[model samples]
Target: MTREVRLTPVNEQNLEPLLSVAVAEAEPDEVMPPVDAPAGWSQARRDAFREFHRSHFGGLAGPTGNLMYAIEQDGDVVGMIRLGRTDEPGTLETGMWLGKSTRGQGIGLIALRLVLAEAIAAGARRVVADTRPENLPAVNLLRRSGAVLAQDGTTVRAEIRLGVSEDVDLLDAG
Candidate 1:
């Protein structure tokens, strides 16, 4: 089945649905690092989620700049991708999250390729991603995406050089 994965801008119309994914998480909601809430979430949760995303979408840019995109599959939102430039020239850093139900379905790989395509088009020489070292799924995702992995104490960094090319299968192989 074709996922028809594409990157779209996040706006008010789609923000709630994205948050709903977090709220739907069966865990107790918190405004902290893994911010989450419930269906009938309080204003506090909304504010926190908005604040965190605001930075990614509109607030002060990180490092050089930042770009956020909504990950859509067959016209439905499935995840998010954020790209922020690092201090180094021609390099950009990216992070992404997919709805629990969307994991392991090859959507993440598609999103990674899309993000890389955008970054390279914007003149990025390399793309880097940092995830927790213990997050095996994330680590494996990056590795399978052909990124070089380096683990520091707290963060595992994966990098892809955009100026180079390898025969990668965009939809089937990661």
Candidate 2:
């Protein structure tokens, strides 16, 4: 059965669980920037993870702040999604990463729809995401989410306008 997916605002209470999911179920390269450790979750890598999330705790609103949330499946932290204001006004740029164990269960699509609701609520006219063509899963997710994709070299930018549409209506109903 598919578990209920929800976006929990990242806070001190859930940060540890988010980090636990990142280290145990995903590789360092998959979810984080490069740390001093080459393999495994070292003290430096773990610290870096905490620092990364901590840096956002204070700034979740305003023009320059980012909205961060942990992707919780059935009450367990499984991944994360973040939306930040882009250089273009009324546009928000997003990024997400899920643990390897939960990659193919349609969790990403659910989480994505949830985030889209958040984006609309935040008064964003469009949401954009960037991924590599080789990451077929992400490419497919963005396509299914109704994003108009444009490629520049190795990066594929998926732009979803949050105006009236079937997807936005579904987000409203759900």
Candidate 3:
């Protein structure tokens, strides 16, 4: 049986596994995904990614700009989930990436649920996501999680309404 999947707030200390997953899955398998490699695999490229993540992860872009979480199983990192604010107020978008080995097994669905919960707590009334039309895993996850799909061009965008409220209990509230 598979173990229960859990989420840890992403931080500098436990982010290595997340970066590793991106590199390990950069190459497409028998099935191609719309997303590409995390960027280049060179050392310079890796350095750039590290620097960029540090900024975004550090919240330098503001609280709502990039909120990320680490997907964990048995205390080990397996993937990452991120919720980001769009240009529109009170709206957010989500994205996720899992290790090739960790795909399926209901991990993605759970991660998305957790992230969307956090989004709701953060005052997002709506969240949207998009993937290639053939990315059935994502399409299905969104549907199963109650996101409405809007297909256009070669991609489909999933939108979930979290409901607007003036008294949302923000997750970061101290």
For model 3, state the Cα shift of residue 148 in Å.
Answer: 0.6
lDDT of 2 at 113: 94
**Candidate 1 has what TM-score?**
0.79
What is the lDDT of every predicted structure here?
0.72, 0.85, 0.73
lDDT of 1 by residue, 12-81 (tens): 7778777776566422232224545544466766677766665656511443266777788998877788
TM-score, cand. 2 vs. native: 0.89
Residue range with the least summed lDDT across 10 consecutive positions in model 1: 165-174
TM-score against truth, every candidate: 0.79, 0.89, 0.80
Model 1 scores what on Cα lDDT?
A: 0.72
Off by over 4 Å in 3: 27-40, 60-64, 163-174
Using lDDT, give the best candidate's number: 2
Ranked candidates (lDDT, high to low): 2, 3, 1
TM-score of 3: 0.80
- For model 2, state the Cα shift of residue 87 in Å: 1.1
- Report lDDT (Cα) of residue 65, candidate 3: 76
